[model samples]
Target chain A: MSVEPLDPSTLPEHDNLPGNAHAYCVRLTGPLFVQTGRMIAHYPAGGGTIRFEPLTATSLGTLVAERFSSPLYSRDWVVANGQGHVLLGDRGYDINSYDLDEGNLTVRAANLLAFDAGLELKESIVPGFLTLIGTGRFLASSSGPVIFVEPPVRVDPEALVGWADCPAPALHFDAGWMGHFLGAARGALFGTRSGEERQYDFTGAGTVLLQSSERLREDPHALRRLEGEVRQLGPGALQQLQAVVQQQLAEHQQQQR
Target chain B: MSWRLRTPRVLVVDLDGSRGSAVRARTGSMVACEGEVSFKDAGIGGGGGLRAALKQRVAGESLPLMEVSGRGSVHLAVEAGHVLLLELAGEVLRVESESLLCLSEGLRTDVAFTGLRGASSGQGLFTTSVTGHGRVALLSLGGPPIALRVTPRTPLVVDPDAYVGCLGEVRQSFVTDVSWRAVVGESSGEAFSLRFEGSGTVFVQPEERR
Candidate 1:
């Protein structure tokens, strides 16, 4: 309950606020890539300014092209430049910073708060996650404290945050559930999912990141990714997808009723 | 009698009827009360009379308050938010109307213009200002409030959604530069941030207002 106000000089570089786990303070010397809207506050250096410019800004075109490689996430990230201490938060999640010295790590896009410009960011082939390569530090948030686990494990899709030095996980379906789905009576194939029947199986040598809670945060980039994938569908496939969406809308309306 | 924090989210006000002790609190914030206590509306103007009422109407910074008095202690809370108690010693405490939970009888609440800075923060154009010597309770959303110290050398910039309030001599203004441009498809969410100069303390919450 004792809150000693912190100034730039006293604030830690890349650490959670004292007595608070939901907010983090980062001392900025050069440029840092930050997720849009995650910045809570910042203290500029004496007579200095910390400018938050979009990745699309012309002044940052060359720098962004060099450090940032994810097109789907360009709109969701900004380049923070100048000298100062910046505080970042994400919906009150637990914030943690990880340093990668000539290593790589992949993390969920929505959970990543910011990363140093020294690291290069690339789009992970596994869809909603982004891969950070080279070296430097990055900040990410989780619904609860992150739990580290070795490979040769299975994790709930909703609880899986990201994995490091591991191959993308393969979708694993419970044997009993698969038997039920493959049975002659396929009527319950889509409607009778208990949600626990599916998990991500990791068999390689690497570490997996998992949140204590199974609650999932709504990802803003998910829709855009789906939109990008839709461009590859044929005309007939597009019509069938529309019909499926209409059916989903009808079912959703019925549930509301 | 004064304010005692029962928990981070709960506040209890000890009142003595014989001493004519009373407090003005946000309407619908009382959770429980012991002994003989009564609640009364703080009138149309929220205690500052006709002029304040007109300003509140125009500024959309309406504060609906209720006066609590009697022989017992009253428990107060709102939206399950964390409570921050402050002892005001005559310095003006400018805060959001919605964040105000309780105020001592001696303090006065009024509306003040905050210019375009408030507009981008989604706090409208006016903010509620409290003055006088008394106890004040503020409600912070998401988590415990963080107090940042500002001086002549270091200026602070804050996202409007995360800003709670400020005390002392601080000047707030909106900065809309090329960096404030909205992305191609997305709204960029943080189009601008409130910049504070001079020497003062600024308070911010851990979570932004959605």
Candidate 2:
């Protein structure tokens, strides 16, 4: 079937093309905070020019400093100012928009695509994640369709996309050390691919987002966090840490073969 | 336009066994055939003669093509990518050599120097140009390609990594705001992008090329 080429007038408003999870068209009336390089095209309905100003140096610098509270993401974001229809897509991942009514939602930093300026962005306590607060719309991308599940459960660390309106999750172990030891004694020993050893334990109340695909993008924020953490070490301790990292790197390279 | 999609990833072309017209496809792209068919390499520079072949070799934009003839339904795919069928009416299509899947008999394919953006964008310094009337099918790494309308008044700035191709009379220039981009560190990926101006259509994929 031949699909008609979509221009500004024919584009969808605040929605995605039917059955298309990879691209989203937003009828931008006001300014929108978008991740760097996510805006593929913008069609101005009023024929006004749309300018993307870096969040750190925009004319709306004061406003950006207030709404955007994370320094790590300051360079990675830009404010789409002016009138136009902006189309966004993220590496062929499925994108979904969520509306929060004065609630809080946190998502992996790389997956958070765009958010309304009405929402305040903050660095989540968890590394590699960002939290959005206030009543507004936000967009996030996942490797696959996100599955929503209630808390009071444990989720695979790689599969966990984010959590909404909930307390932070803690590392959960299988709690069967004795059983594992007995299995080892019976020759069913270590690393048989049960995938049951570790998980993120989510209790209290709220929703957890899970992605069917476990593929992950390299986390830049996590690296920054690690770099920031290393600043607290002494020179001697730093050298020792480097030695450990080198040993780990060597072991990893060997495993790849 | 008469072609049918065997799947989202595979395009099926039914050739008229008696016609002199032929379909030139990417080399080694023929996956299946249902009727009498013959496959032959389209030779140096994908049937564009010696000059074009030399230009392609010098420019480093290689378009390896094989001519598919005879009648039958043929299944074609490239790396499980999505296929987009485009109908061109005498517009110059400047596309990366890697994305050009197949071209009709009447189309002319040549290698053209596209300037320095190719080296920075990773799409090569030279692009394949397809002109004349016919169908052109393109392959993309992710989702359907976005066809953007560019006018003189509304110039478009696009990340070079996501750009697939463009059709019509357009001038593409490299634009990079170094003042802000320098602060983004080494991993920004796209410190330089392409700015297109003029009347025509620009195609971009959802994913940035790695």
- Whose DockQ is greatest here? 1
- Candidate 1 lDDT, A1-257, residue by residue in tens: 22567899899987999978889999988889999889999988878788888888746778889999988888888899888899999887889999899888989888899999889999988778899998899999888899999999999877887899889899899988888888847656887578899998998888999997744657777788889889999999999999989999999999999
Best-performing candidate as measured by lDDT: 1
Residue B184 of model 1 has an lDDT of 28
The runs of at least 3 residues in candidate 1 whose Cα sits more than 4 Å from the true structure, single-residue gaps closed, are A214-217, A252-257, B18-20, B117-121
Q: Write the per-residue lDDT of candidate 2 for residues B1-210, one digit (tens) a residue.
A: 247788877988888875544689999888898888889999988998899999987887888999988977788898777888888889899998888888888899999876674334345357899999998889876676677778876666666667888888888877655543654454454566677788888887777676
| Per-residue lDDT of model 1, residues B1-210, tens digit only | 768889988989988985437999999999999999999999976887788899999888899999998888999998777888887899998888888899988899889888864333346368889999988888877678898988878888888888888888988887666557566237546766788888888888888887
Q: Per-model i-RMS in Å?
A: 1.5, 2.8
The lDDT per prediction is 0.85, 0.80
Give lDDT: candidate 2, residue B167. 83
Query: List-wise, what DockQ does each model earn?
Result: 0.66, 0.41
Instruction: Report the C-alpha lDDT of model 2 over A1-257, residue by residue, as the tens digit.
Output: 23455666567899975557888888877778989867766665455656677876688888898899998878788887887677788878888999999999999888899999889999988777899999899999888899999989899888878999889898876758546766575556555446757788999889999988755667767777888899999999999999989998998999999
